[model samples]
Target: MEFFTIKPCKTQAAYVVEPKKPLHLDLKALKVPFDITARTPVLMAMRIDGVDVSLYPSGKMLIQCDEPECIAKKVWGEVA
Candidate 1:
């Protein structure tokens, strides 16, 4: 598993990681109250079934914060 991030630039909100892809992510430091397409966003990589989630940072930067579990569940359908 590997982490994939999409730095939000007022244009992109989140990266649609194709289904079945292994993307590792730790949403313990993501911003909050961020509109789906308003605040900056990051796309970490991970597998659906089960695998090691590898973390990787994005190129763009912004006011970083922990990714909320509630928001993750609503957006990604799951949170880690």
Candidate 2:
């Protein structure tokens, strides 16, 4: 199955990536290298390459950058 579906954001230079099914992620336990700017029970916001990235427990991500697809691939890796 496809790991995620990607679409460009209508109001910004960004992309939204979402999994086919909900993914329960522990925001407090994520080991991402980016500096997290905000955190809550349901969301984690970080900065990467001078842009904003918002992660959700439901396997949805909003990435604002010039190459969002590339960043998404690197973040989630090769999922079958």
Best TM-score goes to which candidate?
Answer: 2
Model 2, 1-80: lDDT tens digits are 24467888888678898877777888877777777899887998887778788888876889987677766665565221
Alpha-carbon lDDT of model 2: 0.75
TM-scores for every candidate against the unseen true structure: 0.19, 0.75
Judged by lDDT, which candidate is best? 2
TM-score of candidate 1 to 2 decimals: 0.19
Error of 2 at 22 (Å): 2.4
lDDT of 1 by residue, 29-68 (tens): 5433333332222543333222212223322122222342
> lDDT of each prediction vs. the true structure?
0.32, 0.75
Error of 1 at 32 (Å): 18
The per-candidate count of clashes, in order, stands at 15, 0
